[model samples]
Target: MSPNLFFQIKILANITELRSLIIVKQLLNSTFLYIGTFS
Candidate 1:
């Protein structure tokens, strides 16, 4: 693949990873809050 295309793919992968991480963090926080309320 061309260097430019490779670089673009890498950036896209990084962005996807970052988005997933944020989503996971939000899910964890909400789960904790839900359990806390029950207790």
Candidate 2:
């Protein structure tokens, strides 16, 4: 594959990784909040 195509794929992978991380963080925060409320 070309260098430009490789670079674009790398960027897309990074963005997807970042989005997943944010979603995980949000889920954890909400879970903690829910537990705190119950206890």
Candidate 3:
């Protein structure tokens, strides 16, 4: 495979990872907020 194609794939992977991390963070934050509200 070409280096350019490899680089693009790497970038796409990083973006996907970042999106997953953000989603997880949001879920955790919301969960904490819910617990705090009820506690």
How much does each candidate deviate from the true structure in C-alpha RMSD?
Answer: 0.3, 0.3, 0.4
lDDT string, candidate 2, 1-39, tens digits: 999999999999999999999999999999999999999
The whole-model C-alpha lDDT of candidate 3 against the native structure comes to: 1.00
Clashing pairs in 3: none
lDDT of 1 by residue, 3-24 (tens): 9999999999999999999999
lDDT at residue 14 of model 3 (Cα atoms): 100
lDDT of 3 at 10: 100
lDDT of 2: 1.00
Candidate 3 regions with alpha-carbon error over 4 angstroms: none
User: How well is each residue in 1-39 modelled by candidate 3, as lDDT tens digits?
Assistant: 999999999999999999999999999999999999999
Instruction: For candidate 1, give the lDDT of residue 36.
Output: 100
TM-score of 3: 0.95
Per-residue lDDT of 11 in model 1: 100
Question: Clashing residue pairs in candidate 2, if any?
Answer: none
- Model 1: how far residue 20 lies from native, Å: 0.1
